[model samples]
Target: MHKTLEGVQQSATPAIRGPLQVYLVVLALGLTVTAPSRLAQVIAAAVFLGLAIDAVGVRPLRWLAVPVFFLIPGLAIILVTTPGHGLIEFGPLTITQGGVKTVLDTLTRSGASIIVLGFLIASTPVSTVIATLRRAGLPSVLVELLLYVYRAIGTVFVEAERMQTAAKARVGYSNRRAKIRTTKLIASTLFLRTIDRVTHLDEAMRARGYAGKAPATAEAESHGYGLSIGILAVLLGVRIL
Candidate 1:
């Protein structure tokens, strides 16, 4: 996670302040949810995707595939299960026009929302995000917990990579059965290791007079949002009028 974040930080465009990014994401999501037609949803998705690509290049778009892949099963169910004028009949199942429309609508909305979130995460630093959340009235305890989880993701990913490399060196994934066993071993071992690490971390924090409050990080000041605000207004106008 940290390595990926470092790559994001190297992007050509500087990210806007976290609060502005949050507002942009929220507006994009609102437009997506209340979109009157599929065309409107597509426009919303396209605009935000273009923004994301512009800010961080194409690196972050790869994460979109994960959600899209997971949506396939649900979208397929909607395609086959929803009743309407039949588009196709195959093996006692009928794909309907209405079902197809529903699927497209779902896809567009999900794509738009995900793109907005991806852009926000890719552009903003984690500390800025935490500060934004705190400013938005999130409880300190929840924020602190979230911060720990965010940091832990990097640790877990690093450990997983190291384990996978070592396993590969030992022919851990040489066959199908071996692959399954190796994955299980890695997961179990990772869990135990994470627990140990967390225990030590807790001890370290306590030793340093850790408190229940979240540590304060300097928040990025808002600036240069005129263009973004104008673009967002135009998009909203397109959606509404």
Candidate 2:
């Protein structure tokens, strides 16, 4: 993971502990989905966005753009396909009142969830999150799977960087045509290599007498129960009123 994406790894003041952080995320998500109106959802997202920025600065927020952009197509689909009083028309496509409402609801729900999860990743390394989940009695199989997937993503990223560097040295992207061809080749090769890598990893784990469960990590004491409680309370208040 990039350093900028890694949130405050360590803080002088005790922040939300691992378990508490997980609980807060769950609670926030629950509140977000059940939020009665867009205003409530927006407030929840705003709070999380503030915390994320305060933890890691604004640079990491740029990643938020990726998810938001993806949501655009989904929103467009909902706008055209949903049936209701016609609000606008473009040739065969018609935007309906129901569709607009659905889009706003979807946007708020997705935006809130994404921002909350983004804050989690920014504040803690994924390994720590996996460990926290394992300790929280998340199924061992699921925890192990998450750990391996995280490792695999890192491995793939490094491999892709090496491949790109090698390609650049060979002038693989010297022209527009070359760039497209190089990208296509790299993607296909990367997929094949990833499969091979996963196979080797599985073999290695078996060689080590891999059991159904991975070893549990030592518990690290964390604080911030009060802060978590406060945040959850505020969200509940907003939902109720």
TM-score of each candidate structure, all chains considered together = 0.67, 0.69
Candidate 1, TM-score vs. the true structure?
0.67
- C-alpha lDDT score of every prediction, in listed order: 0.70, 0.72
Q: Give model 2 RMSD, 1 decimal.
A: 5.6
Which candidate leads the pack in lDDT? 2
lDDT of 1 by residue, 84-163 (tens): 99999999999999999999888887777666666666566666667777887989888788678655643454466677
Across 1-241, the per-residue lDDT of candidate 2 in tens digits comes to 4442323444312256565676687679888888888877898899888877777777645555445644777898998999999989999999999999999899989999878866765566555667688777889888787667655654455456667779999999999999879876776677567668877977887889877555545337666788788888888888888
The stretch of ten residues in a row with the least summed lDDT in candidate 2 is: 5-14
Clashing pairs in 1: none
Off by over 4 Å in 1: 1-3, 10-12, 138-218
How many steric clashes between backbone atoms does each model show?
A: 0, 1
**Candidate 1, 14: how far from true, in Å?**
3.7
Candidate 2's C-alpha runs over 4 A off are 1-14, 141-219
